[model samples]
Target chain A: MIKMRLLNGQPQNRISMADRAFQFGDGVFRTMRCTGGAIEFWARHYSHLEQDCAALGIVCPSASILLEDLSRLRPVDAVLKIIITRGETARGYSVPDQLLPNRIVQLAALPAYPEQLYQQGVKVRVCSTQASWQPALAGVKHLNRLENVLARREWHDPDIFEGLMLDRDGFVIEGVMSNVLVLSDNILSTPKLEQSGVSGVMCEVIFDAAVQHGLQVEKRAWTLDEIKQSDAIWLTNSLMGLLPVSDLCGRHFQSHAAQLLLSGALKQLRQKEKFAIVDLAGMTKG
Target chain B: MIKMRLLNGQPQNRISMADRAFQFGDGVFRTMRCTGGAIEFWARHYSHLEQDCAALGIVCPSASILLEDLSRLRPVDAVLKIIITRGETARGYSVPDQLLPNRIVQLAALPAYPEQLYQQGVKVRVCSTQASWQPALAGVKHLNRLENVLARREWHDPDIFEGLMLDRDGFVIEGVMSNVLVLSDNILSTPKLEQSGVSGVMCEVIFDAAVQHGLQVEKRAWTLDEIKQSDAIWLTNSLMGLLPVSDLCGRHFQSHAAQLLLSGALKQLRQKEKFAIVDLAGMTKG
Candidate 1:
């Protein structure tokens, strides 16, 4: 696979040993999809990155600078990962008097996923690892992702595509890498992420699309029992778009109507001029 | 200042961008003081590192291999930092089938501290940021330390030596970078770290020393109000052995007898044949 990476806006594949990201996981990152030389939902990704950086007191690089850096990779169907770290420090938790934020952008070949996963959906298991409830750091895609890493380690079977993680209080929060959606009685609801979980970009797009389609959309806390009783279940993220959960903890979900509706809306959004550069061929069809 | 670093037992100063430590904070680390070519409490530090790595399912490098790597640094008065990451993986959280843990060791000039900090103590303030409660990760010095970074960011005053962080329920846990100890009457108490906080190596040594000295010790939950009513407070860490907290949230403390007793015990420990290689001149005298 062809790999292209930039560190501090320069082509480089290595970072200093003292980089805060390497030391304390003191950073935030965005995993975006890039196709035909343009990024999918660049504006939204940038906005979210700004908010996440602000939450951690990091100075985010301007969109123009990041765009220039992305352009260095040229046109490609790839996974784009951007990491903004608080840069190198003199070996302590305190922010240095003179701080320089490190920007790392890497483009790699798009990961191949089994087509059947999108077409027939996937089975997911509940993870024993509970997400920590840190309201101060909740909802931001920061580098402190040990919880997600640990939760994802709960299963090794290729048959299971994702693991659902609950908060310390046993409230269903999110999937290991995606935001969750539950549809029941014409209502589209997702977990409230104010206490835990990352607020995924695709989840926001789905919420907006649901609102545009005259659907009742709600962001509230739900229990695992409530999730099992939902008519349909889906997971959303930038790379995977929307993946319906055919089986969750032995409770099978049959309805794909809500997933189809939201994915169709996302497809339409991709066709708009702002996102026209995205190559649909690069994405797996559901 | 002379600096020496090793990556996976080889001389190197940079790590691949794909290192899990940089991506997901998937690692554990230890910070120790080196004097006259010998690491302070090497056995305890190694034991803690092994336990921490085991907790995160990362294979720890053997003591002989790590000792050889440290030997490359030769005899020096410096600070030693060791990081063991789960190495790199294909673009996700799943652990790779064939895993190789990355061991990084770095030696740098010991940080200089004011003699007054050890003698008269330092002032500290309570941080507004609350530490997250992850029982699985509690007491282990794993790399998911954004909470500590955020808490350290809460204070910028040079006079304020450290910030005390509370857990989710407003119970005082530990300082941003050190374990806390409260002295009230004849009792020496520290927060129980079963819920949150890094169990500092020096804190453990102090606990053992207190017992040897016949001082009554207790480990339990404490609040800011209780901290204010304490006779004296102190912070302990590997680098900064122990420093009394003269002021906390405007409440001043005058007793230094407890601090002296503990420091004296540490001095005796340093005199042992096993620790004879340590250089007493390099430390700040209380």
Candidate 2:
């Protein structure tokens, strides 16, 4: 599908090659979902963007400016991507004395996935590519995502939806594109991203929903064996929402009541945001 | 100075916002020095680029194609940056079923530095930021350089020529923009990049020069304390060739005869490549 892009609040398809984003991946980005002409959890996404920019010392554009840029797009079922870079610099890692952050917002048709996979759950594999330890960049959705790209490249089988990545120390960190959650004995535990992994927005929503539903939530390190021992496993992200994992590294999991509870809570959260459920079953071809 | 850029063999200043280089840093790059309309170490740089692209499974552009693109620039004295990305993709980490790599080559005026730096050496500091361990990406010079950017940001003092980065285990790896070399007991040693750090082309040249000059060379892990005990230290890169380090973290070193031997050998290596000496003393302003 053709994509529409806005560069710095203008309808443009290209960015300067000098942009630090292209040069050094000196930036942060967000992949957001848009439904019924409104962005889902936009305030949360913007807050996260600001926090990430602040972490890198990049000046984030004001929310009103980004809102106006988003408003310029034609309201349709789509995915909105926001990239904020440290603008252009002359051949150096040091930030320029005077710098302006470049903001890019693009809209593309929502990717179609097999609806059956969502219902039956996806099969995931453990990727050999390990996420590196960088506490300063941990939990921020920055654009230095070659690790994710490499992890996703590990499997090409259409049957597999995502690949789980472990840290160098063999601790289950996250999925290539999503955050992982494990349920065991009425508790919801997700990997602590203090050292690595991207702390996803949907993962945040799931944590809040679990707390509201009176489920104990623990954020700590989990080995692959420990994760496989869970009563249920799921991956959460902004676009995919919550997708239960049916199989991980040959270990099978059954859909449990806890899955439904969290799913129902997420549905209510979306409904409160006026997100109309788009029937994606018809669009699932592959 | 305004920089001239070429995208996909065409003179262009911008790249598509969807370009994977800007999105995920799914690419590799080479920063080369150009003198009198000839690119220095073109063969070595191209070979490294090909190796890096192959490492990521991206098709490397033919040497002839890149040469044709580089020839378009009116190369006075400049730094030519070549970035090859896995091209544009939809909104995901998975490589597309059909993919085409994008090549970007740009030229900018060479940055001027104090001539005293080459003679008296530079003061380097140990960065608080540590390089992550990712063997998959080790020595490739890929574009995911947020780690370098963060390290560079850790110091703004003009006196500091470069920041030394250690691996997660506190083993000295490399400088932010250069490779680290140590001289001890008439033996030259550099940190092994098997686990991390960019395997610089100039570092390779220095190794060859050391062997030609009959100097002992060792590639192994060395701690910061161990590095300080060295007779002398140096940083190497394509642009900055074999710069001696007079002071590292306030530990001063006298100019040793071993440094002069290596420096003279490197000078002969450059002369063999027909790289004319450009007097940069007059250009040093700040």
DockQ top scorer: 1
Q: Write the per-residue lDDT of candidate 1 for residues A154-250, one digit (tens) a residue.
A: 8888888899999888899999999999998899999999978898888888888889888999999999989999899998898888888999989
TM-score of chain B of each: 0.93, 0.93
Model 2 TM-score on chain A? 0.94
**Candidate 2 residue-wise lDDT at B168:** 82
lDDT per residue for candidate 2 within A169-243, as digits (tens), equals: 899999998899999887899999998989888898899899999999999899999888889999999888889
Regions more than 4 Å wrong, model 2:
A273-286, B274-286
- TM-score of chain A, model 1? 0.93
Compared with the true structure, what per-residue lDDT tens digits does model 1 show for residues B163-250?
Answer: 9999889999999999999888888889999978898889988888889999999998999998899888999998898889999989
Candidate 2: lDDT of B39?
Answer: 72
Colliding pairs, model 1: none
Tens digit per residue, CA lDDT, model 2, B72-131: 665668888889999997668888866999998888888776678878999999998888
Global local distance difference test of model 2: 0.86
In Å, residue A29's CA in model 2 sits off its true spot by 0.9
Candidate 1 wrong stretches, greater than 4 Å: A273-286, B273-286
TM-score of chain A of each: 0.93, 0.94
